[model samples]
Target: MDFKNEKQGAFMVVVPAGRMDAVTAPEFEQECERLIQSGELKMVADMSALEYISSAGLRSILATAKKLKGQQGEIRFCGLEGMVEEVFSISGFSSMFPVFDTRDDAIKD
Candidate 1:
């Protein structure tokens, strides 16, 4: 996966492109860690360009979400479609994290 970073007001957005599967999940995790370490805990993961995801990808996101929660921070995801949305729903994660249809919605949350 490729990640493009953007800053909008107080939020940091990470726009990821490509498949966020087992092979690329670590990169996502690393980016999250970097954000957290930098004290930019409010994160918006713009997944509009993402085409695929695996269990490992979900796990990585969950871990990052939990970590941010502990810091009293928030994380939101946006622009999921196709199998990516299915995986989140089937895993019961759709209700666990805040997801939005657009990056603007996610950032607003």
Candidate 2:
């Protein structure tokens, strides 16, 4: 997976592309850790370009979310579709996290 991070007001927008599996989950978690350590609390994960996600990927995201929550931070996800969306739904992550249909919507709050 490839992550592109951008600053938008008080939120950090993270755009991840490609497959997020065991091979890439650690990198994704590390990136989230870096953001938190750097004082980036509010984040929006724009998954529009993401093609696939595995259980490891979900675990990484859950870990990040828990860490962020402990710091009173938040993570929102947007633009999920296809197998990626299915994974989130089947994993119950769709209800666990804030999901939006668009990046713009995710950042609106």
Candidate 3:
């Protein structure tokens, strides 16, 4: 996965492209950690560019959420489509966190 980040108001918008699987899951975690350490407590994950995701990716996201929770931080999602959206919905991730249509909508909260 190729991850990119942009700061928008109080949130960091995370864009992950390509595929997210076991090999790249750690990279995602590391990036989230780095963001957290940098004092970014609010995040919006824009998954529109992501073509694929696996259980490892889900685990990484869960782990990231835990990290943010302890610091009173939060993670939300936007631009989810195709199988990625299905996975989130089937796995009940949709209810676990806020899912928006765009970064702007997500950061509004």
lDDT, each prediction? 0.88, 0.92, 0.93
Question: Candidate 1 — worst ten consecutive residues by lDDT sum?
Answer: 100-109
Between candidates 1 and 2, the one scoring higher on TM-score is 2
Clashing pairs in 2: none
Better of 1 and 2 by lDDT: 2
Number of backbone collisions per candidate: 0, 0, 0
Candidates sorted by lDDT, best first: 3, 2, 1
lDDT of 1 by residue, 42-86 (tens): 998887788998889998999999999999998988888888889
Query: Who wins the TM-score comparison?
Result: 3
User: At residue 73, what lDDT does model 3 achieve?
Assistant: 93
User: Which residue pairs clash in candidate 3?
Assistant: none
What ranges in model 3 sit over 4 Å off?
A: none
In candidate 1 the C-alpha lDDT for residue 38 amounts to: 95
Off by over 4 Å in 2: none
